[model samples]
Target: MKTILITGASRGIGRAIASKFASGNKIILTGRNKPMLNDTAEYVKKNGGEPVIIEADLSNPQNVLSLTKSIDITQLDLLVNNAGIAVVEPLAEMTLENWQKTFDVNVTAPFLLIQQLHSIMPKGATIVNIASIASKEGFPNWSSYCMSKFALDGFTKSIREELREKDIRVINIYPGAVATDIWNSVPGEQNLSEMMSPESVAELIYTSVAQPSGTVIEDIILRNLHDF
Candidate 1:
């Protein structure tokens, strides 16, 4: 069984991805929510996968380092950097604390994880970053979110080349407005029904990473049929 690690696996696209790959694999799930992480662990167990749930505050660099201790001896096959946060407000009103928090989870945490876990991730391993369309285009009040994702975009691109010789593929997925809880607390009402489900996004991510060893889907943008 492949050893797969998914951050933010407690819910949304991360949870959906866990369900998709749960048939037979070692899924390492990490997030801040213990109860919800346990629920995801149950799903993995019931579906025939070995599940290891580690509660982590990814915003903390020290916590990211501690995750290496819990990883198994086997090489990590896939690393899904899916944990992220956003502070939605006018740019002028966005606090420094919120801005730093956004980048801490979205960009810094993933960088630290990849750095710490680099030794265990053997050649041919895939790293998937769940970015958003905002990474490419800016929204009125999503400056902090967009900026963080944009940084992730550049990080993935640079690493994609750096890891090329090692045959370690880094795929970046830019999915448009997924119907996730992340959007629920936003100020205005949204057409959640018109948004793409986290399941579909998870399917694509799994498919991209599941490609044959030599093949790599470098960058992809996923969007719903109807624009909101």
Candidate 2:
């Protein structure tokens, strides 16, 4: 069975992805909160898959690096760098601390994880970066989040190009307006119920990873059809 590793697998889209892939694979689930991470791991266990739960905050550079230090696992079939944070605030009023945290989680963490873990990912392995629609289009009061996602897009594309001689697939997926709690934290936001569900995005993530190795789908943008 393939060994798939996913970050932020505690709740929301992360938990949903874990459930979908746990059907017939080895899953390594990582997140900061121990209680919630254990719950996710239990679900994976019940689904007939082994779960390696790693509890670490991605915001800390050391924690991100330390995560793979002791891990002896090699030859990863898939890696989903899905742990990210978004701080919604006006550019002028955005504090340096908030911006740094957002960048650390959304941009730097993923880059570092992929850099450190790439050698173990054999040919035909896949990597998916969960970028947002904000990566391409900007929204007000979300400068830091938008910029970080844009950087993720570039990073994903660059990785794809750099590994052209290999069989590994690098993909970027843009989930537009998912019904995740990230919206709840948005300043003065209202009517979140109008957005899409996390399960929908999770389904897409599963399908993306399950695709054939020889086939490379560069980018995918999922949006609510009703919004069109």
Candidate 3:
């Protein structure tokens, strides 16, 4: 069975993606919340797939290492970098601490983990980076989060180049205004029904993973046309 590792599997698009692939694939779900991770694990197990749940604070460097060390599985067929945090504020008002925290969770942790696990990700493995439309467009009051995702966009391209000969596919997804908790955390007028659903984003992720080895969809921008 193909082993897929997904960070932030506790909620949002991450949870939906886990449910989509959990029926037939072996899933390794990671998040900072243990109870939520266990919930997803139970759902996956009930659906006839084996799921290993791991709890780690991705913002902590030591925890990132610990998480990697705990994985005894030699190779991961798919790795989804889905864990991220947003500290939205104008550049002038954004504190250094907020900027660092955003970078730590959204960019640094994923890079560090990928660096440590690169060798263990065998040839033909697919890497999916859950980015944002902010990665491509500058959004007001989203300076730190935007910058982090932009860095990830660059990292995704660079890594793809380095691993081109090995046939490892690196795909970046820019999801726009998904109806998830991340939006609820922000103070603004948001129409949940008008926004893109997590399930739609999850389906895009599933398609990217299930494609044949020869077909690599490099990038995708999932947005609600109504919002645009």
Candidate 4:
């Protein structure tokens, strides 16, 4: 069974991805929500996969290093950097703390994970970052979120080439407004019904990662018919 490390696995796309990849695999689920993580673990176990829940608040750098300690694997077949936060504050009203918080989880944590786990990711391993459409396009009141994703896009692009030399694949999945609880906290009314379901995104991610080692699905943009 392949070992897959998935951040943000407590819910949303992360939880869906864990279930999609659960059958006959070892899933390492990490997220801040302990109860939700347990629920995901149960789903994974029932679906015929081994699940290990590692509770970590990606916003905290200390917890990022502790994640490495709990992961017991010679090689990580897949790493999904999906834990991220979005604070909908206009640029003029935004505070440095919020911007720093966004970077801590969205950018810094991923960087640290890749660095800490680099040695264990041998050739053919895949790293997928759950970026957003905002990564490429700027959205009003989403300055901090957009900026972090853009930085993530750049970081992943640079490493994609670096990892290419070692035959390891790095992919960035840019998803449009997905129907996840993440949007619930963004303030204002969100048209969740028009958005793509977490399962849809998870299925696509599973499909891409399942491709043969010789081929790599570098980037994907997932969105529903209606762009949010």
Best by TM-score: 4
The lDDT leader among the candidates is 4
User: How many clashes in each candidate?
Assistant: 0, 0, 0, 0
What ordering of candidates by TM-score runs from best to worst? Answer: 4, 1, 3, 2
Stretches off by above 4 angstroms in model 2 are none
- Candidate 3 structure, TM-score to reference: 0.96
Candidate 1 stretches with Cα past 4 Å from truth are none
TM per candidate? 0.97, 0.96, 0.96, 0.97
- Tell me the tens digit of each residue's lDDT in model 2 across 60-116: 988989987846697788889889888887778999999999999999889988888
lDDT of 3 by residue, 102-177 (tens): 8989998889888888787877898899999999999889889899999999988899888777888899999998
What RMSD does model 1 have? 1.1
For candidate 4, write residues 1-228 as lDDT tens digits.
999999999999999999999999999999988999999999999999999988888998988998887787898989999998999988899999999999999999999999888788878889999999999999899999999999999999998998898888998999998888989779798888888999999988988988999899999998787665
Residue 218 Cα positional deviation in candidate 3, in Å, after optimal superposition: 0.3
Q: lDDT scores for all predictions?
A: 0.89, 0.87, 0.88, 0.92
Clash count, predicted structure 3? 0
For model 1, residues 1-228, the per-residue Cα lDDT tens digits are 988999999998999999888988999999999999999999899889999988899887778888777665558889999999878999789999999989989999989887777667888899999999998999999999999999999998998898888889899999998888888768889888888999999899888988998999999999886765
- Against the hidden true structure, what lDDT does model 1 obtain? 0.89
Off by over 4 Å in 4: none
